[model samples]
Target: MENSTIVPKSSLDFLTQLKENNNKPWFETNKPKYLIELNHIENFAGALLHELSKTDVLETASGKKSVYRIYRDIRFSKDKTPFKTFWGGSYTRATKERRGGYYFHIEAGNSFFAGGFWGPNAADLKRIRTEFAHDTEPMQKILSSKSFVSNFGTLQGEQLKTAPKGFDVNHEAIDLLRYKQFLVIKRFTDDEVLSPNFLEQALETFKNMRPFFDYMSEVLTTDINGASVL
Candidate 1:
């Protein structure tokens, strides 16, 4: 694993302060510290990505050589800290159009990571939804796996089974929409992210779940024929 510095408490505090000081000239005043933190996060993300790449798990799905990135979308939001509360990383096969990335939620602490195919546009969503519905059993099996279930919380999975909002799982396409992406959601609480043993456990969990991604990759690459899909 590439070397990473423990994200400093002072750094997080400064970012929180910057977010609260809307009227003040915080950016100009704290330019150096801000730049340093940004760089530090970038390095940390890169290191984490390197560690992930060492495993052959993310072959076709992740699409890019450099997996980690900080999301740069900050429009009409109350939180105006220049730095992000999270960093994300992922890879995909060369054939895929774009990189598949996952988030490291900082507010929930950084060891946690969640990833799956996301529908940025209508066409993408359509393909994913179609595939999800086509091979429901296999998809459900992976989602319900002990390892996978642990990540999303058992209660959340049961809730998802009922479908979203007014949607019913008994409905045809609508009910199956949530199953479209092969999401591998893992949680690392504050203690886990901050602790070495917990962090190691988290990484091992990612490694163990690698097979599920492999299964999804195979299914996605296969033709739409229902029998051959999963």
Candidate 2:
């Protein structure tokens, strides 16, 4: 209910202007405004972290720590835009026991909440594929649940056009096994992002991801014998 938790219209306006004028000169002139908006976003991230900690453990120390830098790393990119057009951040769950992560992106028309394994290592990918190949029912049930469907629509991520080396193309769980990354996403409209209850709504969306996260955590932390790896 705090004012800091609310996304101010001015903040969004500033981002919109930044997108139109992405040059360093324009940004330098408006640096003060940018800093003010960043503070609001940091407060929102901090408050979200506080609420999230009540239900889950996080390794992120503070809201500021969770926020991604506004400056884009363009060393390897063709688009040499010096500043990012949006504000984004992520939260990593605490310990090796808790797998997966949480992310939020705030932009004029692209606001979204996303969480899951963006890039699984070779070992973890193989293990996950093995589990799906053995039995897809558990993961299938979670993905097919009403809450999951309502929130994320469907499982999403990069996938191999053909099955991975060890997985059969015709395997029963091949659809899931082909995935190289596991992710779920929920988008929000500008109206929704600027709403008073946006913070609470964001928390609810994160909470809804628990079943999928818990399932992956179990798979990643154990061997075939179901013993802890960590």
Highest lDDT against the true fold, candidate: 2
Candidate 1 wrong stretches, greater than 4 Å: 1-5, 22-24, 57-94, 97-100, 108-112, 120-124, 154-174, 178-184, 197-202, 226-230
Candidate 2 Cα deviation (angstroms), residue 61: 0.6
Residue 152 alpha-carbon offset, candidate 1, angstroms: 2.4
Compose the digit string of candidate 2's lDDT tens values, residues 94-200: 99999999999999989999999998999999888888888899999999999999999999999999989977899988889889999999999999999999999
**Which lDDT tens digits does candidate 1 get at residues 84-143?**
444344544343422344445444334456655554344454554566666566666776
Off by over 4 Å in 2: none
Worst 10 contiguous positions by lDDT, candidate 1: 153-162
Decoy 2 TM-score against native: 0.98
